[model samples]
Target: MTVVAHPTDPTPARAPAATRTAGRIRGLDAARALAIFGMVTVHFGPFPVRGDDLASAAYRTPYGRASVLFAFVAGVGVALLSGDGSAPRVRSAGRRLVLRAALLFPLGVALQKLPTGVAVILQYYAIYFLIAAAALRLADRWLLALAGSLTLAGPMAIVLAQRAEPSWFDAGGNVGIRAPVALLRALVISGYYPVLSWAPVVLFGIWIGRRDLHAPGVHRRLVACGAG
Candidate 1:
């Protein structure tokens, strides 16, 4: 007796990554737009309540939130640029990031000279960008862990620094380009957007960007975690 063999169906191929509209992620753009708009309002919007200005809708809603989103977005951008841990490309990207940081340092100082009322972020952002180069090769879990660690450590350091030197953070408006010591202090420990505390957000973003963001499971997790 001879037995017949049955044929099995072939596996299906996966579709390529999807982008919103065309060649871009609308969700990212929308979040960025919210951040930018919030920052603008925080700076240029009116203060109906004198000493209570900070508690106003604009400041209360976006003052810190926008900056966090902006930093996270920046990290995500870097992760994408690095091709999600592609070492060879990250090396080349790191060079570009270094040059960009160099340019931003002076530009931030220059912006300070312009008498802009808002606290400038470019200088601190430059430092954050440079630091990111060192961690570009870390796995997503490690990046997330570091972010969590930094988040906890940042506030503690801030408290200690304040106790050590209360006046170190006060800028009296803007510290000119000549004040390197004050500038460094502000970048590391104090200032509206201290890289000390904010660095974690950036790392978390880099980790998030490396994941399969378009997938339903990932999206669900992002929403749940973001809300938490």
Candidate 2:
């Protein structure tokens, strides 16, 4: 899928970085930027955009949606990085994604130890990457089916898990690796962005990522879905 500089170019097999960037969808870039801004607003404050009267309203906009957007965008990234679902090199992609997770998990743990009150989401993000690695091997229909099932069952499962073991949830707040089992519980069920509940969003993003996004028909369908 390399975009050569010209039809007769000798290096048609490999596109330059600039050439690749030129071919990128600007809309996706805007979405990613907006999502990042929203995350920053949630983590810090929307001070730059606020007036005295509109402060509360501004803060409310990105509250819960930021993390969700991040999850979705992360899924899209996974798809694009692994060659856009056409004919993924699953083993290679899995290895790369797992290595990223391995690096991120420890870093996330360290960030959690900081005095800053923000709940570190990087650890959960690491888990999501691992999930994406596994998901890269699935067909589109299966991915959609899995996402739908998770959407229905994940939140319910979390609620039940919390009710059954309140102490585990409590331990989740204590950010340390001393209790590995409790850490696992928190990551999967009790943490701020638990994988059980959030994985579907990522899966849906992967589904979206698989599509021919450049198509006008696809854009129309996406718009219709949003409106519905």
Candidate 3:
């Protein structure tokens, strides 16, 4: 990743430190940038591309994975923006997240009225933010444990719910303009990215955010587990 020299190079030559954030996690931002690029490809390019070419590879690769990365990274952002491991800071973070969600939910609903074919993820995104807000107070280990359990059990629960009563409640895609009853159903049970299935990724990312990324042990675990 070091294009100019080894990370531990002895050379004193370097760029200005103006861009460095004393406490920022650079890796999370890099991952987010890559996720955004992947999402762009998925949104603009045609699926299947009819060949074993770059387009087809892009189409197939980013379909589901990019959004997962995006959701996870957003959770990390929440943790970072909330500051560190403190109660007041966490509450402040929760307020910011809730307010942002409030603004985004209305924008998402308005966007739905447009003719764009995109299956907007904003409404589901707002819900994910809400979930992350509540989860930020949990200890790191508990967050990881919950995320792991959710990852294993969420799909099964979704399957059961769908079988038991499919779309029995559709709050018209969570658009407040669309009947109030349909809002809950569209956001939870019948949405394109159900929180039940996607929220774990966010939680897991939040768990990751709680780690000391500068530590060698944390980096090793992230590399090992992410590779796995």
Which structure among the candidates has the greatest lDDT? Answer: 2
lDDT of 1 at 87: 62
RMSD of each: 9.0, 7.8, 8.7
TM-score of each candidate structure, all chains considered together: 0.81, 0.83, 0.82
lDDT computed for candidate 3: 0.72
Model 3: residue 157 alpha-carbon error in angstroms: 1.7
Query: Sorted on lDDT, highest at the top, how do the candidates line up?
Result: 2, 3, 1
Between candidates 1 and 2, the one scoring higher on TM-score is 2
lDDT of 2 by residue, 97-140 (tens): 89999999998978887888778888888899999998988866
Please give the CA lDDT of all the candidate structures. Answer: 0.72, 0.75, 0.72
- Candidate 1 lDDT over 154-196, as tens digits, reads 9999999889988986773266667777877777787767877
Q: Quick one: best TM-score, which candidate? A: 2
Please give, for residues 60-137, the per-residue lDDT of candidate 3 as tens digits: 887888999999898777766656556787889899989989988878878876777567788788898999899888
Clashing pairs in 2: none
lDDT of 2 at 155: 97
Query: Candidate 1 at residue 10, lDDT?
Result: 26
